[model samples]
Target: MNSHTAFVAAMIAAGMFVLLLGTFYFGNFRRQKPALWRYVADIDRAGAMIRRKEYDEAEALLAPLASKSDAPLHIYQLRAAIAQHKGDWVVAARHWKAARRYFPDDALGFAGGARVLLRAGRRAEAVRMLEGARSRVHNPSQLTKVLAEAAQSAGDWAEGARLWEQVRNEAAGDIDSYVRGHDCLLAAGRPDEAAAVLADGAMRFPRDPQIVRAVAAAAPPGAPGPA
Candidate 1:
């Protein structure tokens, strides 16, 4: 062939080689650079195992990943959840505590740890942890409810009543909180205070049978009618 044609052929081959190299480089960059995608994939896989009720396998898969990365909050959270489900309150508490360390701002992590601590009968510790968490939480009604229950279980009826009242105020129209608050107040031996709480609850939930019953129950047998 002519030298001109040979040169053109060589140029086309070189161009193809450069295109192939570029494609390979980009593929490697996507796979090796950043690395977050692979970590995310492992998290997803562990989540799927959790959904399938394969707690052991899920924990196995997540443990190493959690240890390997700083962003493994979800992994630690899932491990805590699994441990709680398995009735290993101590293990759950440890995992949740680890998760909180990695995500100190995570309300759920602190809440979970508090729950496990309460279940393990570490009421005072749970209260302290939850109280600290409460200040950090933007919306703490649910966590307050949990703390209330924990305090009640630990025979701190007064503290339970206080927590429930706080939860009731934060709920702002939640009938369940009103009902729980009334019950907690009565249990705390503040019957008169319970009566007042119930009266206010009746105003908010006028048609709720539970609220009406709670108010009636809070009153003494010969006490005056609703105030």
Candidate 2:
């Protein structure tokens, strides 16, 4: 080939390579830059503040970021956590609600809301929130126990008994269920049933003082205590 023709071909090849490289670089930059730069800066700053135990300032910074319509769910979650740490229950609830709006099926948001309600002494509301969280929670036993305790506080013995039974069943080998079940039975005025439950528990856990005492307490006036 002639030198001129070879040079022209080489220039064309270099130009195509440059164009391809520019296209890929700019495309990657355009796709990643705004998300990485815009989203991460505030998130990282907020995280740093949280790590430094400056929850209020972290939350203040996160709030505007989280308020954006397109803000990430995690951002809202962080804001909620910050609000909770700062004892701002109302704001925490609002942030959690916003997080839930973005991810309706999020277990953490529901659980967090329930915890806030419980802390705020809104037992009935907490129970309702936990009921909604039941399907979403991987392990609802803790929340169920809290709900049962709330019921007990409200003097709803029947609901408390049912919930305690559920917790006892979930706990399986744990003695807490037996204790709670015994107390619940006694509280519900079913002493005979309580005696039976305690007797059975004493047989299974012979060394448990609570079980022994429960059996004794539930027995009829002339009934013998556990041997």
Candidate 3:
């Protein structure tokens, strides 16, 4: 063929290829859209069932999703929640680990597993788990907060105070950290540090009744107080 004829033929072929690709892409997306909606609906239904304490029903609803090879993180989380509610610590831990494996960047599984282990009276295990996962977590603040809670539960007042202080410093808007940090420092017999923490919270949350009361009570003997 002539050079001009060859160029025209090549252009026509390219247009046909582009048209075919667009057709296939849209067709597949349309076909998958309903499945995606159904998946979301199922997740919502399972969540409601879990909230109602219907473990069996929630599990049943999630079974199909769980069987899929590409199951999302929430599926494992829901499974872990169900297991935890049923007092199946081993199964719950396994599901949490699976979630962590499936979604490596997320801290939810590590936090959830640690909380469950703590609730099961495995304080050391909970601490160890969080410490081990700390380096891999996308957000260490979440894990740090849970570690602070674990410290409080274990009566490690010094450690709890330090962890709470770290938590409050790393993230803002958590009034619990300030209150708990003060309480922990007091328990550890550091009244000055305790007072400092409470004073900081009072400054940040001037209108909060709890902080106001705490600050008033935390005032040193014979010291001037908030007006």
Candidate 4:
């Protein structure tokens, strides 16, 4: 071939190579960016992986998307939970704390953070954090049980009873919670209060065996029946 024709063909070949390379590496000429959709799909799979207790795989899938500005709030939640599954309470608490800012009205962050601390044997800090979280929480009913346990951890039987009372009120048929409340009151050396709770239970659920049994069990030897 002539030198001029050969030079022209070489230029065309180089241009074609650049076009294919851009399309392959950068997803050129596609709708939005392919990576964005892939990120979303990765997150969904990661959540399922987390549920399956594949923490390492879930974390690997989430790591790249976690740094995205528009990353889902559950990314941090899952990270914290993954850490929790691995028994790394410190890392779990840190991620849960970060997630808390995104979920100002939800108790997941506060509850998870406090629970990890409690499990890690930091009762004082856990209770303190849980106390602060109480006001910020929007759905008290949803967290009644969580708060009750935290109160028990803090050795605040009165608070535990109060939260269990909240639970009982929210779920009127929740005899289990009322029983727990009585137990907490008894633990605080208030047998009278314990009997009172059972008595109230019997009044509310006249036919429930739970209330009948609890009332019988809560009484002290030779003590008058609950008022």
Considering every candidate listed, which one attains the maximal TM-score? 3
Per-residue lDDT for 1-227 in model 2, tens only?
Answer: 99999999999999999999987876643322224356787888888898888997887787777645456667877888887778889999998786556655555666667778878888778878878777866667766777777777678877777888888777655566677777777889987766666666777888887777766776679987666
Compute each candidate's TM-score over C-alphas.
0.56, 0.47, 0.68, 0.55
Per-residue CA lDDT of candidate 4, range 1-227, in tens?
A: 99999999999999999988987754433222224454667778988998898999999888776666555566788898889889887888888887676565677777788788778788778667766776888754545677788787678998898888888887777887778899899888888877787777888887777776777676668967545
lDDT of 1 by residue, 72-173 (tens): 466778888888778888788889878666566657777888888776778778778877887776557767878877877667778888887887778877
Off by over 4 Å in 2: 1-116, 209-213, 216-227
On lDDT, who's better, 2 or 3?
A: 3
User: Any idea what lDDT model 2 has?
Assistant: 0.74
Residue 87, model 3: lDDT of: 88
Among all windows of ten consecutive residues in candidate 3, which has the lowest summed lDDT? 29-38
Prediction 3 global C-alpha lDDT: 0.84
The prediction achieving the highest lDDT against the true structure is 3
Candidate 3 lDDT, 192-216, residue by residue in tens = 8888888889889998888877887
Please give the lDDT score at residue 60 for candidate 1. 87
- Model 2 residue 28 lDDT? 49
